[model samples]
Target: MKVLFCGDIVGRSGRESVTRNIPRLRQELGLDFVVVNGENAAAGFGITAKICAELHGAGVDCITTGNHVWDQRDIIPYIAQDKRLLRPINFPPGTPGWGASQYETARGQKVVVVNVMCRLFMDPLDDPFRTVDAEIAKYTLGRSAHFILIDVHGEATSEKQSMGHHLDGRVSAVLGTHSHIPTADSWVLPGGTAYQTDVGMCGDYDSVIGMKKEGAVLRFIKKVPGDRLAPAEGEGTMCAALVETDDKSGLAKAVRPIRIGGRLPPAG
Candidate 1:
């Protein structure tokens, strides 16, 4: 199975970059399934039903979100109707949307996508480790599911990497998001699971992590809550991770980082 996991989409630039490149990417990479982190898709805050429709129309199979998933109040009611849109699995029991969902490819192969957020320097939600362990137990690799992808949205690299290693041989891939800066550590783990500390954001890199440079800098320097930060209005680079898994074992056969346009150097 060939799968692609796109990092967070910040704003218009990120959205355009993703919607514009997805069709071509699907053809170029021979992707069977695509998952995108859309937490910051709406003007750098939260996602909405309209944005969800656009991403889905552009070829995204599932959309994952983080802490900002609820920044847009309108999403509260919409989330219940969209099973493809996921909040963190570790969210409290009554969270609106699902944390994990099962999808099928054109070939009728099953793919399980799980979204979980870390607690370190983040919201004090349920235990991600235990929560994900229980989720994984629901489906067996290679038999019940052809591919299992986990999106570990977190602020700490150590926490994300720990999740990757903990589920090394069990899951097909464990990719990180929310950092908005691509890391160079893209590789298959010893147990055949694809891993990366972060896949980066699909937004302008010229600014501060996809935000306007001025306001973000002012807040830090002045030690005051300056103007609200906004997404950088420059060209965006679509950042993602491509993983190809073995058909029989459902383990990663190859892992590669993908960066297109904007400031980051091209890679696949």
Candidate 2:
């Protein structure tokens, strides 16, 4: 199975980029499923129902969120009914929306998408290591699911990398998000699972992690409140990962980071 996992989509620039490039990228890569982190798809905050639907209409099969999942209060109720939108699995039981969902491609193949958030440097939550184990156990090898993709949303790259290794043999792909900067270590693990420290944000690269440059500088330099940070405006880049996983074993066979448009250098 071929799957593409896109990093956080910042705001207008990020959304526009996805709208412009995702259809073509999906076709060019022969993607069977696509998952995008929508935590920052709003104006550098939480996602809204309208934006979630826009992502769905743009070929993204599932949308994942992190700590910012609740930034938009209006989308709370919609999350309960929208199976395509997922919050962190480690969230308490009463949290709105699900943490994992299954989708069938037009070809009739089943794909399982799971979202989990790490505790280190993030909101305290249920143990991710234990939580994922239980979720993976729900599907047996070679039965209900042929593909399983996991989105580990966290701030610590080390924790994310650790998760990639922890789920090496059990899941198809383990990709990281939350940090807007894309990492270069996209590779298939020894156990055949595709892994990357981070897939990066799909927004304007001209600013600080997709936020407006001057404001980010002010917030950091002055250590005080300034104008609200806005998503960088201008042409944006589409940052994501292209992964291929084995059907029978549900492990990644290959992985690569994809970055197109905007100002950042290509992944080498």
Candidate 3:
């Protein structure tokens, strides 16, 4: 099973980059399933219904989010009905949308996509390790699913890396997000699971983690709250991971990061 996971979409530049390159990537890369983190798609806040539709139309199979999943008040009811859109599974019970969803490719291959936010330096949530254990127990790769993809959304790299090892042989891939900066450690674990510390943001790298440089610098220098953070308007670089998992054991056969159009150059 070949799958691609895009990092957080920061703003209009990120959306435009996805809109422009996803279709081509889908075909050129021979991707069977595509997952995108849309938490910061709307002005560097939360996602919206319209943005979700655009992403779906752009060949995204499932959209995952982190703490900012509810940034847009309008998404409250919409998330409840959209199975493709997911919030963190660690969210309290009765959360609007699901945290895990199963999707099928045109070839009749089943893929399970799950999102979990870590508790370290992040909003209070259920123990992610246990939460993922329960979710992985429901379906094993190669039997119930051709591929299982987990997006570890959090602030600490230590926590995300821990999740990757915890589900090493049990799932297909454990790709990290939420840091908005691509890391260099893209490799398949000893247990055959694909892992990356972060896939990075699909937005401009010229700014401070996708926000405008001037405003971000001002806030840091003065140690005072300044204008709200805004997404950089320059052309974005799409940072994502393309993984090919084994068909029999559902383990990762090959993994590489795909970065294009902005500051990052061929991080794969």
- Which candidate tops lDDT? 1
Local accuracy of candidate 2 as per-residue lDDT tens digits, 1-268: 8888899999999998887888997788788988899998889899998898788888989999999999889989999998999999989989889999888998888888899999998888999999999998998644688888899998998899999999887888899998899988999988888899899999999999999899888876796778888898988898999988777777777898888888887652
lDDT, candidate 1, 175-257, per-residue tens: 99999999999999999999999999999998999999999889878977688899999999999999999999999999999
lDDT per residue, candidate 3, 19-73, as tens digits?
A: 8888999899888999999999999999999999999999999999999998899
In the order shown, what is each candidate's alpha-carbon RMSD? 0.7, 1.3, 0.9
Root mean square deviation (Cα) for candidate 1 = 0.7
Ranking by lDDT: 1, 3, 2
Point out where model 2 deviates above 4 Å.
none
Q: Better model by TM-score, 1 or 2?
A: 1
Q: Is candidate 1 or candidate 3 better by TM-score?
A: 1
TM-score of every candidate: 0.99, 0.97, 0.98
In model 2, the Cα lDDT at residue 243 comes to 89
Better of 1 and 2 by lDDT: 1
Question: Worst 10-residue stretch by lDDT in candidate 2?
Answer: 259-268
Error of 3 at 62 (Å): 0.5
